[model samples]
Target: MLVLKKVQGGESGLEATDLELVQRCLSGEQEAFAEIVARYKKLIYSVVYNIINDKQEVNDAAQEVFLRIYKSLDRYNPEYKFSTWSAKIATNLCLDILRKKKLDHVPIEEIKEVSSRLDTPEDEYINKEKSSIINQAVSELPDKYRIPIVLFHQNGLSYEEITEILKEPMSIVKNRLYRARLILREKLMPRRKEEVL
Candidate 1:
């Protein structure tokens, strides 16, 4: 997939950003839709799976997520942040599905995995404890908190940019970000204290 090129650090020749792919799709290039979906597949799937916590529901949500994207491609407003828009759609859909199914709730201690970053020496394991704790705390956030935190930290989006994607008041975004950090600190405080800030 062209997105694998993104993961491979630009070795592949995709030669476009996701917005550009949307542009092509809007202009009647249906094939371009596939490229855009491929680009975001991993991220979208990961987010959906974390919230749903059911394999079949996650898979169905993943497909429907792409379907919504495809159907909404015509209305894709380039002025807004794409990833935020995508996240909002995914989050709402998951919530709606949850309610419609009347699913029984389970324990919330979901253990999500992080993709391995650069390896460190064994001696540095303890040194990395704070970073690991912060990540785990973040992973535990409710979808509203977790999604914003992931977008801010993992996707490297600025607050203004995130504001557009979420279509949420900037104040709400800031509150979520602050609460997410505070929650992380509290969660990690007892375990370890280094590199928290």
Candidate 2:
């Protein structure tokens, strides 16, 4: 859906020579795969952590994600776009983890990072409250809406690249992204403003 053109040029760190890495991995050289892993581990961890929550669980899921990538190296097709392919694996695994855990609802309030009773209690409270609300709203989104918003705003992916990653139509990408912001705004309204702007 999202056809990436020049609009996403500023987010440079995410892109890599994935094709070359995949080729080398497929040729039975493990070190090349390690380089690829090092390059993307943080990004992949963020995606997984968004779903799994726990640091240890996120680590395991992230490892499995790379392992899956390694196994699929031979089948990797350049035309499909490497980031898209890898993210699909990560998203699917996260879904599987969620399903296996049987989490009826997300515990978003608990995920916000708050200092342990540090000074400047006023600032801490404000930051905590803001983070908790945002996290809760984002956590409540359906995976479809959730993933796109996280990848777009949090991961700094452009709509075009997001379309490539999600493999959805351009309109659907636009609509869902639009809708996601609406949901977050509504969810946060009671605690903040009546309007997003």
Candidate 3:
């Protein structure tokens, strides 16, 4: 039974940078790996969930990502942020799973909407409906566009980071995101008009 340790300050009572944690893990500190798992579990899970869209597979995929990270630690380049590297691993794994399983359709209901406090029930309902519409549009995008959108908007990764993760040029990443938004706008325009009418 492996336990995830709480992320904490290093032995010097100061926060450890990700590089330092990786170095510690490389130095045979098992607890360091636990710390890494604890730190990145949510990120891995979110990336997996967004791509896979299957709640039942998310936990297993996240665990597999951690295993891959641990196994590939030696290949990690210190030039990149560990989080970025881990995200790349998660993204690749999820994409591979998608390819293998032929699972590209993400249900709108599975895409959790971020809710904010509203003045009335009507406002909340309208907000939820709009979110659902947007998510549904996004889900319909081609994988090349959709992956970048999820990474940029949902995962909050920078264009440069997404470029690194996806192994695409920065311009391509930016263009994909642009195209994705354009596609979404086109898809939602009629709905917006219907609501207004």
Candidate 4:
């Protein structure tokens, strides 16, 4: 096991390496597994939340993701990054949940209400409003485009990575992402013009 030291303010603190932690967990260390959960719970939850709008469903999906990961750890390829593998699991679980559920288009007013909670400067608020419009537009997109957009834009994944996660060809990933952006532009244009006028 590797114990890494962090130098903050010239004081060294110990940090456990992810691989070491994984190995320990594989060797039946419950605390190590807990550490892994602590490290990745938010990531898994965010990925699930992006696809599943319902908070309860998101929580359930996140739990399913971790359980699947735990069971399949022996099958994980060490060559790929752990986050990438975990993200694939999360994305797949979310897709499964989405497929099982009936989706409702989120109302723009609901988006406005959600965004209104944060008090920011006027310019920031305007920007956030614009962003909310864009989000609504994204939510309206067909799954083909929406999945790629969330994976590439929100999750910061590469086209190749998205291809692996979605089991689509690289060409398809690129095309979907491009089409998603174009659709968002078309959807937001009228609102943009209204704001200008």
Please write out the lDDT profile of model 2 over residues 118-187, one tens digit for every residue: 6487777777777877887888888778778877776667788778777789899999999989998888
lDDT of 2 at 28: 79
Candidate 1 collision pairs: none
Error of 2 at 65 (Å): 0.3
What TM-score does each of the candidates earn? 0.64, 0.75, 0.89, 0.81
For candidate 2, the 10 contiguous residues with the lowest summed lDDT are 1-10
Q: List where candidate 2 sits over 4 angstroms from the true fold.
A: 1-16, 105-125, 193-197
TM-score of 2: 0.75
Clashes of 4: 0
Could you give the C-alpha RMSD of every candidate to the true structure, in order shown? Answer: 6.3, 8.2, 3.2, 5.7
TM-score of 4: 0.81
Model 3 spans > 4 angstroms off: 1-11, 107-119
Please list all clashing residue pairs in model 4, or write none if there are none: none
For each candidate, what is the lDDT? 0.68, 0.74, 0.84, 0.74
The positional error of residue 154 in candidate 2, measured at the CA in angstroms, is 1.9
lDDT of 4 by residue, 1-197 (tens): 22233212213545666676677778897777777777778777767777776775777788889899889877878777777788899988777766776564421222233454665798577767777777789889988888788878777788877888888999889988888789888888898799789
The order by descending lDDT is 3, 4, 2, 1
Best by TM-score: 3
lDDT of prediction 4: 0.74
